[model samples]
Target: MEFKGKLSLWQRIVRAFESFDSWTAFSLNESGRRFGAAYARYAEAMDLFQVRGAKRVGVEILGEGLTLGVGGLLVMLALALPAFREVGGDDWLKKQDLAVTFLDRYGNEVGRRGIRHDDSVSLDEFPDHFLKAVLATEDRRFYEHFGIDVIGTMRAIAVNARASGVVQGGSSLTQQLAKNLFLSNERSLERKIKEAFLALWLEFHLTKSQILKLYLDRAYMGGGSFGAQAAAEFYFGKSIKDVSLSEAAMLAGLFKAPTKYAPHNNLPAARARAADVLSNMVDAGFLTEGQVYAARRNPATPVDRKRETSPDFYLDWAFNELKHLSDDGKLGGDRVLTVRTALDVSIQKQAETAVESMLRQYGDSYDAKQAATVVMDPDGGVRAMVGGRDYGASQFNRATDALRQPGSSFKPFVYTTALLTGKFKPTTIVTDAPLCIGDWCPNNYGRSYSGSMPLATALAKSINTIPVRLSIAIGDGNPKIGRARIIDICRLMGLTTPLVDTVSLPIGAAEVTVLDMTASYAVFANGGKKADPFAAVEVRNSRGDVIYRRDRDLPAPKQIINANVIADMNGMLVKVVEEGTGKKAAIPGVRVAGKTGTTNAYRDAWFVGFTGNLVAGVWFGNDDYQSTNKMTGGSLPAMTWHEMMAPAHQSVELKPIPGVPTTPGGKDAVASASGPKGFEVAASPQRPAVLNPRALDAIGGIDSMMKSIVTRRGPSAFLEPAAETNLFGAARSVGGRMALQ
Candidate 1:
């Protein structure tokens, strides 16, 4: 205006441009030259039109000013033609990207990432006043504008020119919707033109309400929240309908800069910004001064909710599964997937808490720096998993990724393999004496020996020598039983890790993951059915259509082992908890059957077990393979297992271990040796050939002890009378100087 008042019209334009910095002055001059050229072309076209009209009328018809005005209209129409072509395409009207949400087993939302659409609400669901507040804060003339606001654009340009940087955006709500939906956020002349064109397209195609809805649904709120309803829920912990005027103003203020004005991060700054929005609302006539004052008095503060545990481990596993199930195992861009997972969030939290607590409690004393736990159902649904003490500190999923040796936890499979061959029963006496197979010599912990004991007793105590001797006997050039037989059993039980056929294989030298181990234990829990542990149960799209759903009724689980073998395995494992190494893991009212494991030099301690309904596996050790301070499987690992499983079974029904005898104390009693419900163990026709004289002598002592115990107990509940081996010897005394393994 100053330049216009001081000089002639032409001189005023030139002087005003000359006063600008180089870039602004150059842009203004270039625009003027283009405008002049267009005007010249339009002038020529108008003159031709006038000549034709005058030729018809025999006189000049139209005035020069009117003709020039009509010619300018034609030039403007030509400039707008390209934008029409660009926005007329079908792709321009597609929906914005929807985020993925993860729900727990009971259909409660546990996590959300990507652009989650599960909680998106329609515009009709929001209060009218909230919508009014949004429009007032963002665009007061939204209903009257075509698409681009010329006055707003000019004001923004002037402000930016003065600042020498971008300080404001001239986008209306619809224009912002266009940019968010179809364009990248890049500052360039071409992109700006496209944004303007798309905004016009949106206004032409959608109603004002539709454009506002799109904007509200796609806007980013802080703390991984997107959309209006999610933002409200994230900040206020309530539905959009329940948001007060002040809360609505606060949410509206976040549109300008979510993190900058995020009340969760800086309350004072957010309140100040909200005050600006409230003032805007008052000025826009959407709110009265009194209303604005009332709103300003009660500002909404961001909710102080922090996630209990990082669900990254579970989500990462689910995402991999989702990708594998998608076309060609690839996830395309901007997908909206709802995964219904088998995770029990409560149990997961408990597991995480237990791991951290255990580490804190015993880490210094035991030199144990890392631990992992996995909980699963008998039907193969994973309930809870703690991959590490802190997922934020380390994202590596030790439960699913680390393949440490399971040690004695692997003994169950070895015992199951022996039992499945019909040659061994839980009570079948096995020698616990020290034995050397060629160059390999195995020793029990503390070099202890129970002389000769029942197969169940040796397993209960985790006597290392007996399992090795049994593996050697089963695999000793026998056509029926190979050294690798336990490997096949492990695979059937869901252990995917490879195993070696060494003599020590039965003592759990094979490396395996916690998930596989837990699933393997579930086989016994499910009564011999093979459990295929899974995470995702169903997946849905943005429109509430299920893209994938697991078929729960897949042909009955493959029967790997007989029900009798499972029963016998259950009985023996129960005894382990009752009277052996796993006694620390016993839940007083509920029956549990499991095994304890300790690796060489106490590098790894594992406790894997199962209740009637749930199976759990726990591991304790240093990540770098350093030995713990003599922490056996019965110590921290068992304690952590108890801590996790006790809470998990609180609401579960009390059930006895199938085929086991409950104690006179009730549901926890040892099984009758005759077995549950007249269950009979068939005697083997051919007995194992005792190759070593020491083994033969050891077996004779075991037979005599079994005979003595059976006599005293009037049919021992666990041990059965064994068909005596050929070699015989006097029975050794019961107690030994060394401690039991």
Candidate 2:
């Protein structure tokens, strides 16, 4: 409060002494005096002779301990941040909304993928013996400890220390579940820390029984099987609930190493592992010697499924297609779907057999370690795919995933682009001299060049310099523009791999996938239509409601290649198969057209070809990109293609390739000629054939027109025509560009 008037000096001093500020200052002074006295007494006590140094050292140690503890905690939090980020918002726990069961074209059950929420069995459904076996081997103290299992870990550490090696794993089942759910199978201290933290998080969110059930349902049990239920069915042809004690032990043994202990693959090893599991159970008090003796005597025998080969590579690709369709909103959000794919089981077996047989026969000699094959119909429906010789050895899906240089097999695209420019023809003479673009020079396969020859002959012989020369000539001496044109053609025909413009691009320096190469060749096979590769033909919900049908949902394949270009390209490719490097790819009574490609140093060998009915591409190489022993496209890849295609056409009605004359049995008409001169004269398309009355009648009526429209445009033919887009959402036009009159 303000004073009303100035006061005398004595009155002012009294007012200051009575003010609140004076009282606070007096209390602070008194408290400081008392604290000073207490500190003095404490210092005196510490100065005592017996305890002085000890007390000082203890205080320092305590301070250092707090600092180090806090720093270590911060470090741990830093490491745990990534694990927490991996868990991110609990979305990882949500079950997949889509579970798909794949069926072949003939409606046979091929395989199933994705999580089926309805198919998961509870922990109570497992037999007691199986549960005991799993616990005894994987983690005996699972229920007694937190997710870390400190006691079991310590015991395992002691045992391993005594053995001087890692004879036992200290991770709990929960930790394994964490790795399965969120982490890769990497071995590092940071990975262990992340695994431990994630295990703790899982324990916090999920109960013990939930963790057990998830472990049983999600663990991979090999033979391409996942989960205990799938493993039981795949190995014993019975439900997990109905499995015998011996079988249960064997299944439990797979938890350590599924591929190694899989009963279907190695019965003796599987039995030995099961015996170990029994011994573990006895040691853990889950069973007695008397109880385990019977299991040891009567080992489980897996059912004979050696002849049954699931099209695993095909299914993997089809599943990816299904996901794409779902993402594109073509298939609604149905939890369960039955995908009817265009997989021909017979053809798939033939393809697998061909690849395996070829590798077994020539792998050692040629040093070719891996091969990838893809077969699709002319309309782009994938029929059969062999990604590797053995799926169990590697699930890499080389057919769809690996990108290797197409070598001379890519010459067709360059030639097709040249023909599309209206400047090149099959008989156009091209010089096959040493070619150079800038400082880069490409030589012929044998390091010898023919002076000049018809374009068909150059391609038939796979003269490397010819394609390079053509690429430069087509672009008016600018290989970049020519390479871009080739790339555009490849994209138009459904090659999704990104291509680079290089000096050698025209001669197959750019890398491409087997699937796309096969699909690109399909454009010629289908008479100039876009051949966008596809796998799933139909899909239905669990209730059998049609969610997506290829014929009903997809637009007609657009004409992305000109008719003249296709004819020229097909003629050149046919010449390659008939009397050239790709002769080994020829079928006796079939009109086969294809090109052979071998990259530098024989690092990649390819044969991409097609008949009127199907298009197939084969590639041979090592996964490590090692060069084979002089392996050429005309050898192993062509032989494998012929091996598969010969059997694939046995029962089907043969169709003739466009612009190629064929007999009733689909044999090349030129093949019956006596010499190359007669073959060349017969193969040249000098004039169009006259249409017969029956052929005209078949395509003339209004009903025929409507039928053709409906077949091409699907049900949408009754509706308005919308702008067509390719898989990448680019508006598709005729011939992949402005139509030429």
Name the candidate that leads on TM-score. 2
Report the C-alpha lDDT of model 2 over 623-725, residue by residue, as the tens digit: 9999999999999898888777776665445678888877554533222211122111112111122222233333334345466667887867656434122
Clashes in each model (backbone N, CA, C under 3 Å)? 8, 2
lDDT over C-alpha atoms for residue 181 of model 1: 74
Q: How far is candidate 1 from the true structure (C-alpha RMSD, Å)?
A: 23.1
Residue 484, model 1: Cα distance from true site in angstroms: 4.5
lDDT of each: 0.76, 0.83
Q: Which candidate achieves the best lDDT against the true structure?
A: 2
**What lDDT would candidate 2 get against the real structure?**
0.83
